[model samples]
Target chain A: MLWLTFILAGLATTLPRASFIVLGGRVRLPPTLQRALRYAPAAALAAIVVPDVLVVAGDFAPLNPNLAGVSAAVAAALLSRNPWLPFIAGMVALHALRWLPGG
Target chain B: MPSASFRAGAREGFLAFLPLSVGLVPWAMVTGMAMVGAGFTPVQAMGMNFIVFAGTAQLGTLPLIVAGVPLWLIVVTALALNLRFVIFSAAIAPGFRGAALPMRWFAGHLLTDGVFACCLEKMLAVDDSRWRLGYYLAPSIWSWALWQVFTLIGVFAAGVIPKHWSLEFMATIALLMLLVPLARQRPMLVAAAAAGATAVVLRGMPLRLGLIVAIAVGIGAGFAAEHWQDKEEAP
Candidate 1:
């Protein structure tokens, strides 16, 4: 049953994943579809990362470093001329103060 | 397949996963604790390390399995949790156009967030073929191998790792590390910020459904920001 689960999981994951790559060259997606696809990497990432970052201890607590992380992310977002440097600087700032009160 | 390239890619992927262990070990250790709570033996939890590479799905499934949910539900949810991989594979496809099938499959399996971001950076930065692939493979393999091996150690020593050591905290840190080197634009920044905020605001939703809602909102925010910027760029 566990092996079967793995198989099911693998198929579910691999099919959708490989589908676009395998067929992208042959397919002629509309411009709207293409535009949506362009936003995918970031959108999917936001969907996954946001909830994890913000929630603390339980649902209704103070915002905490999760917001700080986002704020830091915004700072990095603004300082986009050299992407990696700002990204690292903001993250360092968060971790340094992550343990502080009222973050 | 060329022996050198095969070894090089696999080696790189494995090493890239190394530092992830420092973060994943605690999470997997918790998974170990969950497995025991759910009546799974430590070995079963350890075995799961090889079988399922996703952190969120592994943590999520523990409860469902414990509750005697159908196997189909657990597997389906895991797949859903990893739905972003579809976007990743799509974006990365163009880079592997002429690569061998086995090579491509290996790359796909190893495409975690860090590895993917690093590889994409390498791909976009370099015009040459040899070093571009090699540089990408270097950190990726390291990270992967570290994750799998430490995952096992976490299972074995689940009891020993300090409770307050903050494994999940470190994972977020590691995640932040990977993103730093990659966020080069307004849309990406807006998307991340909005997504994270949305996730927080929606935290009350059941079964982590709030997460799904937040992600959608964040993605929309990102897309809209990008479109607005494009309009501003028009002469």
Candidate 2:
């Protein structure tokens, strides 16, 4: 059962993940579409990250991790267009907050 | 020449996993620790790493799996968490168009956050092939090795971090940081907001099925919004 599940899940995972690349340039998606595709990864990433940061202790704890993330992320987003800079800034703010009061 | 090229590519691929260690160190360790907390034997936990090959999803699903949530639910959730791989794969597809299938498979396995970003950065920045492979993947190789070792360490320290520190919260922050910069257009905005709302509404659903729903919703929303925006601008 485990093997079967793994195979099925792996196939499901690998196929969509591999679709664009496997189709290999035959899919002539517009440049605008590619630009749109760029947003999907980051957007999907946000969907997973927000709830956890915003909700603390299994309840809504807004001023805590979520604020730290959103604030620093907003800062990073605004200050630098570079990807790595904002990531580091946000991580530093979020994790370092561990030492704060009521944190 | 072919053997040399293949060998060279493999080496670069290995190097790509390296730079990712810093972030991966904590993330993977947390995952391994969670696996331990969930009752998987050490070997099984590590084995899961290779098979699933995603840090966030592993942590997300292990508890549900242990809780005896339906396998379908777990699979769906895992798939949702991993949906970014779709984006990652798509971004690099054009670059790898002329490469062989086996090469693409090998390179695709190296696709992750740090690898994707760093590789794309370096690949796009440089025009020369001489240092291209090394420059593209070395940092990521750093990340991959870091994650594996962190998983080993997290196995030990997993119990140390109290449950309430909300390390998961940090992941959320990391994600917001990752995405906010990319939300530049109407369709992207609609997709992001819709996906986020959907995820929250469906968070209570079985085995993270809400996430899958959210992903589909977000993608569809993005496509629809973009289509509408284009129509409005046209003629």
Candidate 3:
């Protein structure tokens, strides 16, 4: 079942991406769904990021360096628009906080 | 002459995607390391990396897999995370109208955010279908190459590095780089904020079920905001 699930996952991913191309634009999605889908990445990433930073070992860890890292990353992303900048800033922040006294 | 044209198209595509490729490396390596740390065997991690070949989808599904969630949820989460690719497909569909079905399908499968942007930029100017296809292929190939190499390196290194280094944080930062810029629209901002709040609030849910719920609610929030905006603009 695990293997079958993986195959289905692949199909689910590839088919939606391939649908418009293979169908040669035959099927036009409704604008509503398309608009909603536009938010999918933001939602997905936010879901991942929130728990990753806030929840540590099944409890809220407000002081985690991950939170600081994410804040720095958000600023960098907003400022530069260069995708790498946030990552570098966040990584440096995360490590710096870890190395800092009482951080 | 045909091969020469293909080579030139490929070169154009490669250089076009080079900047984005530089950004792709750290994320890919983090993914590779995360896969192993999540208890997947090296072979399994690499297989998923190559076969799925999508960083976002793979990362989206990883936590669910690690938690022994139902297979259906795993598949659904990954697929849901990849829903944006449908837009990429539609946008790029007309350009490949003259190509063969199999080739078109192959191109669609290889699509990524960087490659899609680069391809769209060139599609307007280039009339030759073959050359256009070559342009798409070049970046796809290089991106895949870097992703594979870094992922493998991270997978091997996962064993050597102590968990104290907290390499997992790199994955989170990589995700932020992708996510932050995407919240440009009000609807998208609402979706992101809602998703973050839901995930953090429901962090107690078992098997990371809250993440899926958060995604669904986030999309709902975005959809609602858009509908509201449309109604406001209608009059």
Q: TM-score of chain B, per candidate? A: 0.75, 0.69, 0.73
Q: Which of the predicted structures, 2 or 3, would earn the higher TM-score when compared with the native?
A: 3
Write the residue-wise lDDT of candidate 3 on B1-235 in tens digits: 5577778888888887786577677778778888887888888888888678888778767778778888877877777667657766776676676788898888878887657745665763688877787788889888889999999998988888888877667777766665655677788889998998898998777546787789778989988987888899896
- Per-residue alpha-carbon lDDT of candidate 3 for residues A1-103, written as tens digits (9 for 90 to 100): 5456557767767887887878885776676665565566677678878888888897888788888988998898788857678777887899899899997
Q: What's the i-RMS for candidate 3 in angstroms?
A: 3.8
lDDT tens digits, residue span B193-226, model 1: 7766776676667656665566566667777888
Question: Sorted on lDDT, highest at the top, how do the candidates line up?
Answer: 3, 2, 1
- Top candidate, metric DockQ: 3
* Model 1 agreement with the true structure over A26-79: per-residue lDDT tens digits: 554555544444445555556565556655676644456555655665566456
Model 1 chain B scores worst on lDDT over the 10 consecutive residues at B17-26
| Displacement of the residue B199 alpha carbon in candidate 1, Å | 3.0
TM-score of each: 0.71, 0.70, 0.72
Put the candidates in DockQ order, highest first: 3, 2, 1
Q: Worst ten-residue run, lDDT, model 1 chain A?
A: A81-90
Model 3, position B39, has a per-residue lDDT of: 82
| Candidate 2 residue-wise lDDT, A1-103, digit = tens | 5544445455555665666667767875667666556556645665676566556555655687557756886787678755456556665786678667877
Residue B206, candidate 3: alpha-carbon lDDT: 59
